[model samples]
Target: MLKPFLSSSFVSGTRLIQRPLYYTKRTMSTHSHLDDDCIFCKIIRGEIPSFKLVETDKCYSFVDIEPLSEGHSLIIPKYHAEFMHQLPDDYLTDILPIAKQIAKAAKFEQYNVLQNNGRLANQAVPHVHFHVIDKPNTSTGLGLTWKPLKTDMDSIKTRYEEIKRNL
Candidate 1:
């Protein structure tokens, strides 16, 4: 039998509730692809504490400790993958939808959905994770500087063709 515990949740508002089916540590650790040394894997297995927001069969989300802005959070696949391309499609399917739901539940009017790949790209963790950063004001959240490159249409078209052909 599953155990029940009193917890607060935000569906529309805070309400006392029982733990979700996936809340059990054993169930959360059942993903066969987890990386033993990974911090996220430790969190999922209850080895580390986290303010977890959501957990599905394929994904888990929680508040960011080093938030860029208020309401900053992270969503990650249950499976361990160093890069997005290495993750299975089934795991990818849950990420965006969960992110959207989290944004809505948080009542964030403006936010940025961001992800990084390699160390050069500023990916601090070697795991596939998405960030939902709330932009309550101009100074908060992700700031960007656009740097457009000057290129010939021929070069662009050739590259596009190559990608399309592979797809």
Candidate 2:
């Protein structure tokens, strides 16, 4: 079931508005087997090493080894939900608070909480994880950028109407 983003999104531009499920591609299988072979599962299970931050009942936060910037970190659910939308309801309830804690602890007043869901969207890990990157306070972090596509009004309206009808 397609649904609107739960008021957590920060994407903005003059055009090329964000669509629901735009980043999430075809949903991955909600199978227990996905857990067995998942590297994030291994990390969560203590089979692989990660610099830990916070471990709560539903998820954990840790430093990203291949960080795009300093203090870059990842927040992941304990269970192996391959996509963000595929995660259980409890995960949605649990994630934001912990992410906030991470951003605060890193001493950033502003940050980007990024979650990618498909190969095309740059979801390198099959397991669900949120990238917590602090925004520019100095020359210490990455500068996130988005160039919205320029399209004619007719084409944009046609696309909007199509998605609106579907919704």
| Top TM-score hit | 1
Using all chains and alpha carbons, the TM-scores for the candidates as numbered come to 0.83, 0.68
- Give lDDT: candidate 1, residue 132: 97
Q: Write the per-residue lDDT of candidate 1 for residues 1-167, one digit (tens) a residue.
A: 43322232324356554334234444554698988899987787778899988776777889999999977999988899999999988788667767787788789999999999999988999989999999989898889888999999999999999999999
Q: What's model 1's TM-score?
A: 0.83
Q: Which residue pairs collide, candidate 2?
A: none
**What does the lDDT read for residue 47 in candidate 1?**
84
Q: Cα lDDT of all candidates, in order? A: 0.81, 0.71
- What is the clash count for each candidate, in the order shown? 0, 0
lDDT score, residue 66, model 1? 95
Candidate 2's residue-wise lDDT over 1-167, tens digit each? 33323223333575444323112232223324347678888787677899987665566678999987778899888768778778887666557766776787788777789989989888999888998987666566666468999889999999999999999
